[model samples]
Target: MKQGTGGKIINVASMLSFQGGIRVPSYTASKSGVMGITRLMANEWAKHGINANAIAPGYMATNNTAPIRADEARNRSIQERIPADRWGTPEDLAGPVVFLASQASNYVNGHTLAVDGGWLAR
Candidate 1:
């Protein structure tokens, strides 16, 4: 940013950052740390024109979630919890990433953007 320009830093974190998740205590700790780091970076670098932010994805449909998605009971439970009524696709995160990396969010800083099919809403 010293070169007379601004930069955007987007972190792929998780909803666990906001809530205490089950079974995976370490995962929760690390991702929560990501938020702290993102905010710290934004605070220390904003003067240098750096915009740091994070994306907290909730219940995404991916290999990591294959076991849970495969279990009908668990799948139903998860989908029901999300306001969107479905597990989020990786594609669901695209728009938020674009917005954060573009001028659209130029004024946004140290924010944790949720791309969780509205799961946090519920």
Candidate 2:
């Protein structure tokens, strides 16, 4: 974006970015860093027409979460915590990702959009 063509920089953060999770200190720290740096980038690059932001997903059903999902108790507990009463699917992210990547979000910058199905809200 330094060349001024303008661009979008979408970084992936996590619910851990906003809160600490058990047994994942490194992951939590990194995700928090992602959020901080995304904002920093927006502050530095927005003037050049570069929009930097992040998306934080909560309790997603993905390969990486297979272990958690496999544990019936854990899965149930997680589901109960989310206001949506379910784990987030990859498809749930499509709209937010598209919005962040499109001109529709041209005025959006330095924001971390939580596609967490209201997990954070609770």
Candidate 3:
């Protein structure tokens, strides 16, 4: 990006980055690394007009979580935990994505915005 037109790089992280839950060692480590990398890259490339940031999303009902969502008890448990009273949909994430990709976020860098429906607060 340094040699080309410098732009924004949005890293999609997970809620796991902020807190470690049960039975997911590798996931926790990987997400922690993502937060680190986002900060490092932002600092390194800021002078070149390149912004790097991360978005940490909570439990969303996507293709990757199909198996988990398929189980009745597990799915219910997940929803009950979320303050929003439901799983997040793809549409729930679009606004933040658009803001990050647009000029409105020009001053934002190395920040991890959470779109977790107040999951962290709970």
**Alpha-carbon lDDT, every model:** 0.91, 0.93, 0.90
TM-score versus the correct structure, for each prediction: 0.95, 0.96, 0.89
Could you tell me which 10 consecutive residues in candidate 2 have the lowest summed lDDT? 1-10
Q: Which stretches of candidate 1 lie over 4 Å from their true place?
A: none
Among these predictions, the greatest lDDT belongs to 2
**1 or 2, which is superior by TM-score?**
2
Candidate 2: pairs in clash? none
lDDT of 1 by residue, 33-113 (tens): 999999999999898889999999989889989999999998998899998888888998899999999998988999999
Q: Number of clashes in every candidate structure?
A: 0, 0, 0
Candidate 3 stretches greater than 4 Å from native:
1-5
Task: Give a tens-digit lDDT track for model 3, residues 8-116.
Answer: 9899888998998589999999998899999999999988899999999999989999999999999998888888998888899899989998899999999998898
lDDT of 1: 0.91
User: How does candidate 1 fare on TM-score?
Assistant: 0.95
